[model samples]
Target: MAFHLRPATDQDLPFARALTYEAMSGYYLQYGLMWSNDGFDVAWAGRENWLICNDNAVLGFISLSRDSRALYIRELHMLEACRGLGAGSWVLEQMALKAQALGVLRLTVFKNNPARRLYLRSGMRIVGEEHCFWRMERVCQSS
Candidate 1:
């Protein structure tokens, strides 16, 4: 199913936090990710969060930060029902277009993220490592 993105505002911050906790509680504990309010600080969400929605309702949120150099996807989470439905691939395609528009050759994904496979399938190849994350890049050809 095709998905849509809506820029999240400060008023949506609390919803973002709640959704993050709901979607990631298991993975967070499994991966020993710091479960703290610090990560969801208001300032951070205001800047990075964007809601992923469809005809039914809001599904999840993605945190993206971009600059002239590269587009950084801080996080991408979806509701349980959205899993295995090709929604993530649709979003990745959109990100690739954004990268191409900006003329950047660098994009990265966390090595441990389950979505790494999706990234690899979408044309981004693992290029390097930094800490626990793997940097990736794919030439963004016009679609």
Candidate 2:
């Protein structure tokens, strides 16, 4: 199936928020926590959220915050049905390409996130850890 990854527009915000809930609720619920719609509302309004979709529906999503030197990936979630496929890796590749095009030197991922494996596999490495989150950096390779 053909899929596209693109910057989300305002019209996609509601779907994005619902996708966030679908992806995160399981994890949060494990810790007896849940995300409030108000919080998602605020995040959706403020962050750069990207959506992954095919002809059918949104398959995954990721959000990031960037500065002059780096982009911090705030959230990356693929639908339960899409896990174990290449969707997650595709999203990471897209993010790396975007970072490179923007001259960004690094991107960070949280410590316990399983997606850390994907980031590491894509050539990002741990540079530091704080407050239980690992910070990974992708140094541009010299060709």
Candidate 3:
């Protein structure tokens, strides 16, 4: 399904947060990774959150921010049923386009998360690692 990005509103925060937990909680547990299972950071979902939506509803959310030298992707997640449907790839592609010419695009993926492969396939390279996460970056050529 084709999806578009829009700034997430306050009303959408709960749905986005729940979807993120549903999509990721198990993976984190399975990997024995420490996570915020205790609660969520609603404040962090403010302006930077972007909803991946189609006609019916939101499929997921992604968060981004930037400095003069780099665009940072905080999270990119999809609902369980939405996986393998190419929506994540599409989101990342759009993110790359959004970040291009801004400077390097950077993100961290759980070392065990399959999305690292999607990042790699999108031309992002693993640049470093910390704990159980891998720092990846894609350098967009300046025009």
Candidate 4:
């Protein structure tokens, strides 16, 4: 199935929340930690959330924060079915393009997340790791 990335709307909150919860639950199950809906809701409550959809079904979502110099990838989650299918790479490419357009220098990703492989493949490198997360950055080229 083909996937597309789009700016998330308020109407997409329910779907986004469900995907977030599912991803978190999987992580909790894998690591034996408690996953809470409140945590998901709070993380997505007021951020710039983007939806990865195909024919109206939400496949994944990502949230980001932007500063003058860089964009921080706050959260990214893809359904288990969508993992390893290039959907994650597509989303990261979109994010990188958006950052480049904004004249941002780089984007950041956490270390422990499996998505680190995607970031590295997309040319981001580990700059640091803190709080159990590996921070990565990719410099954008100027026009």
Clashes of each: 0, 1, 0, 1
Minimal lDDT window, size 10, model 1? 102-111
The most accurate candidate by lDDT is 3
Off by over 4 Å in 3: 27-34, 37-39, 42-47
Per-model TM-score versus the true fold: 0.77, 0.77, 0.85, 0.77
lDDT of each: 0.73, 0.74, 0.80, 0.73
Model 1, residue 55: displacement in angstroms? 1.3
Indicate the TM-score of model 3.
0.85
lDDT of 2: 0.74
- Candidate 1 lDDT, 47-83, residue by residue in tens: 5678887765787777777777667666677877877
lDDT score for residue 26 of model 4: 58
- Candidate 3 per-residue lDDT over residues 46-91, each given as its tens digit: 3388888776677788878788988888878887777787888888
Worst 10 residues of 4 by lDDT: 103-112
Stretches of model 1 off by over 4 angstroms after superposition: 22-33, 42-46, 105-110, 141-143
Query: Model 4, stretches more than 4 Å misplaced?
Result: 25-36, 102-110
Clashes of 1: 0
